[model samples]
Target: MAGSIATAGVVCAVGIAAAALVGIGAAAAESQRAAGIADAAALAAADTLAGFAAGDPCSRAGEIAAAQAGSVTACDIDGLIATVTIETRFGAIPVTAIARAGPPL
Candidate 1:
């Protein structure tokens, strides 16, 4: 009976470890998705800004960023700067990306 109990404990520990691994995998996937979204949004915003004059470039960039980000949080843009915040199921995880274009030297 003691041996049986020890075996059961080992199984339970293994099961718990498996569950934790799965959870970690899911979190990693979510993080990757968020990062991809941020990157795309920043690039899109930068492209939009390139065509615009020099007035409210950030707001214009933000609009483009929002469109590309889809369900993610709205993009924040200030002048040539762009930022994005994303939250996952576990908690609020903020992802940020910036885009800048300088004069040709």
Candidate 2:
């Protein structure tokens, strides 16, 4: 009986470990996706801002960034620079990432 109990306990422990590993893998994937989205948004915004001479470039960049990201918490353009931030929840896990791009100053 004691041997059976020990075996059961070991099996349970292994199952728990496997579950934790799966969760971690999922979180990593979500983080990567979020990062990619932010990077693309920042790049698009910077490119757009570069064409503009002046006037509310930040606002315009933000708009472009949000559009590309699908959802963005903060987006802004300063001078020749563009920045974007996005946060999302994937399967009960929260992920956040920021991306920035700028022309030579």
Candidate 3:
């Protein structure tokens, strides 16, 4: 009986470790998605900053982020460059990503 209990405990521990790994993998995937959204938003906003698009740069970034099911937390434009931060959620976990877009020097 005692040996059986020990075996059950080991199995429980392994199960918990597997669950943790799965959670970590999910968080990583969410992080990647957030990054992609931020990159696209930054590029869109940079176009506005460069006078290739109309409307405010930050507003354009927010629109792009919204289309990707994310929210733009911040946006900054310097000259023709644009930097954007975006936020996304996976379950109760919140993931944030920042990206900058600019013309090649």
Q: Pick the candidate with the highest TM-score.
A: 3
* Local distance difference test scores for all models: 0.57, 0.74, 0.94
Count of backbone clashes, every candidate in sequence: 0, 0, 0
When sorted by TM-score, best at the front, the candidate numbers are: 3, 2, 1
| Alpha-carbon RMSD to native, per candidate | 4.6, 3.5, 1.6
Error of 3 at 66 (Å): 0.6
Q: Is candidate 1 or candidate 3 better by TM-score?
A: 3
For each candidate, give its TM-score against the true structure: 0.61, 0.76, 0.87
Instruction: Please tell me which model should have the higher lDDT, number 1 or number 2.
Output: 2
Off by over 4 Å in 2: 52-70
Where does the lowest 10-residue lDDT sum fall in candidate 3? 87-96
Error in Å for residue 98 of model 1: 7.1
Q: Give the TM-score (vs. native) of candidate 1.
A: 0.61
At residue 63, give the lDDT of candidate 2.
Answer: 58
Predicted structure with the largest lDDT when compared to the true one: 3
Q: How many residue pairs clash in model 3?
A: 0
TM-score of 3: 0.87
Estimate, for each residue in 1-105, the C-alpha lDDT of model 1 and write its tens digit. Answer: 999999999999999999999988977876676566556656555555565444454455455545645343555656645555433343555444333442233
Error of 3 at 102 (Å): 0.9
